[model samples]
Target: MKNQQDHIHIFSGEIADYWIEDGILFSQSKPIKRTVPLIQENIELVKKITQNQAMPLLIYLCKSPVPDKETRQFSREQLSQVYKAMAMVSAPGLSQLIMKMVFQFQKPPIPIKSFSREESALQWLQQFK
Candidate 1:
């Protein structure tokens, strides 16, 4: 038995009801920096739906670059606030500013993790109860 709302969205492009062994896989085509808002909103939604349960979230951070620093920083700070078990797989050559953004959130009071590999990231999220 499953509730329609128990689904977990891996990112803007994918969602799954409950947890799958592989978790929900997100596409590399999604806009990384811009998805920060959607991520924030979903975090609240998940928190509400799972008021009696807590599940970790795994995010695939494709190779998409942020294009600029402002967006990177804004997205980073926003993510930090909604902290959950999250990992980002990124492309090479991302601006130093964005890299620092990821670094800033290396450890937050909220659950969070970062990875360059999608599979590894998902595994980390699955470890959460």
Candidate 2:
């Protein structure tokens, strides 16, 4: 069972719980230190969810431990493999701070944005659909 919103529960991945609605992929990230193997598992789940089609992703924010270099590299290289664009919905400033750090290290291969409200994030993700 899940919170009502007509959400389709897809899977409870190693890193997140996934669902899809409105042509967008949604994830509630787990507070876990993402690893290369875990991210790989997530990629497989995502491909299966979208039937090998990349689509916009909306991630609910969680405080995850910083990943290791190998894990980070793998995650960055594989993002475009499953997501065309990404929208992170979080409380004010949290996503912004994290994104700033990510940009400083390396620009994401796909368009990404952060919003404080799920409605706004979903509205923005609609453009990519």
Which candidate number would show the highest lDDT if scored against the true structure? 2
- Assess the local accuracy of residue 78 in candidate 2 as a C-alpha lDDT between 0 and 100: 93
Error of 2 at 6 (Å): 6.2
lDDT per residue (tens digit) for residues 1-129 in model 1: 112234644223222122333333232334444444554555564555445244455543444444455544554565534334555555443423445655555544445555656667666766653
Q: What C-alpha lDDT values do all the predictions have? A: 0.46, 0.84
- Give the lowest summed-lDDT range of ten residues in model 2: 1-10
CA shift of 113, model 2, Å: 0.4
Tens-digit lDDT track for model 2 on 7-101?
A: 45667888888888778888998899988889888899989988999999999988889887787778879989999999998878888876765
Q: Which residue runs of candidate 2 sit more than 4 Å off their true CA positions?
A: 5-7
Task: Give candidate 2's TM-score.
Answer: 0.90
Model 1: weakest 10-residue lDDT segment is 10-19
* Counted clashes in each candidate structure: 0, 0
Residue 114, model 1: lDDT of 54
